[model samples]
Target chain A: MFAGGGKTVFYPKKCPRVRPAPCEFPIIGVPTGEPLCTIPSGYRPNRKCTYMDYAIETNHLSKNYGQVCAVDSVDLHVQPGEIYGFLGLNGAGKTTTIRALLGMIRPSSGSVQVLGQPVGPNGRGPWRRIGHMVESPAAYPELTVLENLEIARRLQGVTDKNATLRVIEQLGIAAYRNRKAGTLSTGNFHRLGLARALLHQPELLILDEPASGLDPAGVVEIRELITRLAREQGLTVFMSSHILTEVDRIATRIGVIHKGRLIEELEADKLIEIRARRLEIKTRDLAAAQCVLSEAGYAVSANEDKLSTGDQRAIDAPEEVATLLVNAGTPPTRLAVEQENLEDYFLRLTGETI
Target chain B: MNTFIASFWAESLKVRRSLITLATAGGFMLLPIVGGLFMIILKDPENAKNLGLISTKAQLVGGVADWPSHFGILKTGMAIAGFILFSIITSWVFGREFADHTVKELLALPTPRTVIVASKFVIIGLWVLLLSILIFAAGLIAGWLVDIPGWSSALLWSSFGSYMLIVGLTYMLMPVAALIASIGRGYLLPLGWTFLAMALAQILGVLGWGEWFPWTVPGLLSELTGPSVEALGIHSYMVVFLTFVVGLSATIIWWRSADQSR
Candidate 1:
């Protein structure tokens, strides 16, 4: 039924992440193949264009499979040299979002700007600067680890064999360089994939589920490598993952996608703000706790031994929670407070309380 | 250029994992050796008299087959067995990728889709060429023991030009295997489909034009049979080459269009 990639599908007007007003920036810069960086007057280019600063920016992007919307008019902006974590649950369109960004499939409607250029832009030059290993550890099994890196390295125009070998060892796969990629263990396969991805030292790396089949130790090793690349090498990384801890640990900024739409785009610090207010209290007169919290503009939800207010400004949660109960003739038992982290924010943004 | 070489090297490595390809080569080498043994057996005077051949040690032990088929055994056995071996090895080239779920890795590479498709064709072409050489070499080796005359090294090498023209036709078998591999879920379906197509070509061949028919050409070319010896020509080479290029190009383009990337 799908042929010619014909008849662009229309989506509804509800674009949750669209900016109220389009911001136009001066197109003056060192021209480096950004899709929208410069457009000649009186000439029409392809559908995709380059954005001035954002490595990737998608406006109203959506992909619907039958009645089910796999990506629902999601908007995303990833800056260069920043590791942005795409956090989501299973079936949350994390992979779909990554796929659309990479031009792996056509969007039903909307636009995608990748590596500062609109996806499918003229010349296809920007892709040469981008490296991606998607969904699984994708590499040629028939090739040795070094051979796989060599192919990618040559394509990306990196002339130094020593540089590729440097990355191979950096990824801790030098010992397995001669082994067939298909014969390596799952974790080693991932290491080899990473070595290939970093061969050209690509400016932007889009890794979908980067830690597939890695153990905790392997994840730590990978996480450390990612941190070094982002911080030391200034390589921008866009990673999608189902694991909350991985996202929390490495993402410079976090975008949680759920059911193909973006649940929220906030800094990792912001999510911790949402879930981190761990309130420990010293009180027994639980009856007045709600009234006391409400008096101070705190919306409190109480379930037996505990009560939580939704926001930080609502109360100095612990102090307010305790003072109210103690003043109502009940001396408290204990009180403590901690801010929300990625896990709490992840659950809150997806609206799934686990 | 480096990219092409790297990919070519990568694909050649994939063959090691497939026992079918190994078996195909092994069987081809064994065929000539076994034929020599059979000639050795026939010279024992029991079977030689039945075939009505004169028994000079020289004439009886000629190249693996040593002489003409008694309208029965040698030619039929060699053609059928050789064709089956090529088909068997050819069946696995594209078929195994879908079976093992490794096509995903292939399509995801950043290179153009055409490059990926051509890599498989290069591999298949190489195998077909190598197998043709082994077959020709086997005949010469067996012919040695019998002291058969007219073992022209010149004719054998030049015959390859004609063989490759037909070899061009045989290239489609891989892409057809690739097409089935694309749509069908596993190795068995592509293998079954390839085997069925070859069988159908045979059924059609029985009607009249089977020997010169495009699909059956590889079998006949491998045999270098009676009428085929005269019918095989420079023009036949071009026809097979054109047919093969058209068929393979169509299959590869269709394969490139499919949404195989995961």
Candidate 2:
């Protein structure tokens, strides 16, 4: 179904993968297993690639168990091939919502369409194009890595043997190919899990806690893999993470769920934008600036030498800050606007006071 | 069929590549061979009171026509093989998928939940069939190595069919056990429940109570006897079929409903 008014029908033929990252940022270290290109070079940022955007769509989908509303009438739309991050404290219904979308649990209200098909109305046929890791590394400890991939390949009707190997190597678990999965460490086991999901070369992938108990390196490994799934492979990813840092880095769009309710939703960039603008303007004479701005009807607060105001709606902030400082008898020497990041922005949106 | 076929191929490859299936099969064969040798050396032919001794004597010698008891060591040997190897196969039939996390991959492959689970049933069923063949091969080897002159080809085939039926029915427990395991997230829950059911059925059989517990009916309807025995008939067959239906139905239902990750 073509979405009217600038909604292009998503298809493999019509859309190609849009590279998200041009170079690996030094902010986080990545594992040596696979080099996931979070931002590939030569990507046109304005291109339309829904397969790389909102590959998963849920419309007013809800699930209720007696009185518990696991997921309440939520509308989730993810861009094609973007790593959509989901966050909430435990029992916020992240897992429940995920399970519902994957057809694990039947929803009590509304509809869920994955890859543009009803998740429950039909059976698992549409799932062929999707690969999901629900809780842990969905792996068999007894089976070797190759054996696991064999099972995954057959299920996906994946014909090319070489392509499967490519995913395995890309996930960087090729060294553990012959070892029993049970013997691998939790981190390596997760790598194998990633390999299994990618073995099918699915258009959409879902991961729940892809880096739960990992050491620093393991976390890096999973994060990079998630980034690659979206940016390099051109696969849409719906991932749930407790660590906001990871979410902040990988997510193109984000949904904050609390007590089974999606309290907020926005583009990740917007969150950064809003956060980067919150500032505390401290002058030598804070009381005078507060009086001057208070008389001028500006959002200026006074505590000691600081007059904090994160308002960007003012016509001229420098002139007002100068005038307030000059009138307060406190010279405007430290009149600066500090940048707030994603974390601060989120806290503010969620009504969290710091 | 395409999904079923793919799942089958995938499940089969997994079992074949794993050492558990091979190791379990080898272990079952060794138990009879190693245990039977010691029994033959220690047991006294003069003491007819000792059933174990009589079975051992029957195992060592080639004189089945002049056997000392109604049955022989073969029943015990076959039983051991059935329980051990059959359990191993059954355990993997369902448990391995969850254990290996292949279930997630399989469930996401777009096959119907029933078909996904049914493919496992089919794979385990075929594995049980392969195990049955292996059991017959082992029995034939035992027969060749130890003399059972009166053990006719008809008796061997009859015994084979009975044992095959027993092993096959035992596989019904696989899906049920798997469902329980998946639900419980541990191996002990399914095996413990299955074993308890088996023990209870044996107690009921001794008491001659409530028809037959689902557990014993498979053993009774299946091939658990000396070479020469009559068919279990339509009544026994119906009971066994019902057991299979229930086991498979439970697995499919649980599989479709249970947390896909678990």
Candidate 3:
């Protein structure tokens, strides 16, 4: 029984009833009973208001396949015109989440709203305004690139006959327009897939592994295309990928899901700030350099035969570290201040290597 | 209406470009061609035996090389071969999306999944119907070329009616193949179901319960069991129609509701 004077309270102690508070926020994992003095920080009093403000929103969205939990309670909010990068390892539920968002899969619990419309009960949604490419790009293999995009255009109800040619040119697959899709290379196949998704000129794009098979130049081209779409047309993009560096370059915001849980979500600038910065010094006498740094009250660790320290003092004044190491008869061979890259940060957060 | 038209156009394009379309058309033509070959063999058993077309102990399957016997062969061929060929078309129409990994493209579209599924069924139906007509025309030509007797407008009309009825009944059973292909997500399972159904129909027809089995009803109507076999009642057509409804509804429901994780 959750009873309070106008404002519902969750007790940290005693039997805290896990029910919807007066604010309509369900008390997740909170114990039942006694009126608590303060509400938990997880509670969102204006969740409905927040939902309308987002282009794509999911509250406590979960999906399970028999015994395996594919996605847990994932609350995600993607703002309009933002390139929200969803990073996860293989089988970490990135595709599952994309499928649920696209209304291709029914979530076992919770709900998904895309463009202010609920996604299901009959796979109904604002699909006309939303374009999605799930998992691998697929097309009618027997159909030519133009024909495939033409089919996509017709199904999307785009009356402009030129829409197919425009997307073909946009995705740089114009050269292969007349070629059967089955004859395309892997990268071109991916481009065709992206072309179909962009053929509709949708306001929101949800793509899974958009750059899975592209060459380096193709990857850059797709990244620039997506970035331009968001900048000029105000397209909202929610893309899931294992390519962390790619996501790092263009993503306005980042979400890291590990093992079906969104472990980290932050702005791009915030990610840059939180990434570990360290002063790395490579010396012939590693033990002496370590000892000198340790004696100077700097936390030191050996990484790949390099004496590494995260001390602000050492980073700010590398000359002082050099002077100390030179005096200690162990002149540094290599010394540089290094900030963690996205790959390093992702590995550190997920504890898994790319 | 526009969405349905658009989806239908899309489905038609896919079917037109697929090699399976030509393959099924060619495969269905074999029914009439083979029936013609049987009429040729039955027309001159001793001469064919001397020419090595027939073995010494081989007996002709169809009794005579007349127009009536030719029509009978065509009807029987349509019942059995039509089942297999139509099943192939249905399986390919529904299963190729999954096989080619294009089902996801159709899932989240302005065109509803129901419309897409219905369009695919219509395409399959139209394709098999055209093949049926082609086979009938070819059968008529084959009967004429063999110079068989019993060529009359009345018999032709009646035989065409019976032949179309067999084709209709065989086509009605194809939705089950489409349903299986969707649920199974490939050609192998539906083709496997087709074979299993064929085997079961043969077994049940031999047991004199062909009228009760939907798969056997077409063969029974074609008189594959025997002309003297009791005529099927209204319940037989009702059962086939019921199967058509169930399969169509189930396929549509699966497309609308099943989690298309692929």
TM-score of chain B of each: 0.72, 0.76, 0.95
TM-score of each: 0.76, 0.77, 0.89
**Model 3 residue A162 lDDT?**
93
Q: State what share of the real interface contacts each candidate retains.
A: 0.10, 0.50, 0.72
lDDT of 2 by residue, A45-87 (tens): 5344443224677878788888888888888887655679997
Compared with the true structure, what per-residue lDDT tens digits does model 3 show for residues A166-255? 988888889999999999998899889988988888878999999987889879988999998887666789999988888989899999
User: Which residue pairs clash in candidate 3?
Assistant: A15-A32, A15-A33, A16-A31, A16-A32, A16-A33, A17-A32, A17-A33
Candidate 3 lDDT over residue span B1-262, tens digit each: 3999999999899888989888988988898888787777777877767756343322445767778888888898898899999999999989888998899998888788889989998898899899899999998888888888888999999999999999888888988999999999989999999999999998888887888899999999888863433659999899999999999999999999999887
Model 2 error, position A53 (Å): 11
* Model 3 C-alpha lDDT versus the unseen true structure: 0.84
Report residue A155 deviation for candidate 2 (angstroms).
1.3
lDDT of 1 by residue, A1-354 (tens): 001122111111111211212322223221222222232444443333322446678999988777988999998987665689998898999887776776656677898977555663111325656777777766666667877677666555566779778998788888988888889998998887788778767768889889878898888988998988877655778999988888888987888888888977877766555665646443465556666766767676676785666456544545555666667666567555646665666676677875
Per-model CA lDDT versus the true structure:
0.63, 0.64, 0.84
lDDT of 2 by residue, B129-204 (tens): 7755765676555545544345566666665665565666566556667667767655667777766776775565
Count of backbone collisions in candidate 2: 18
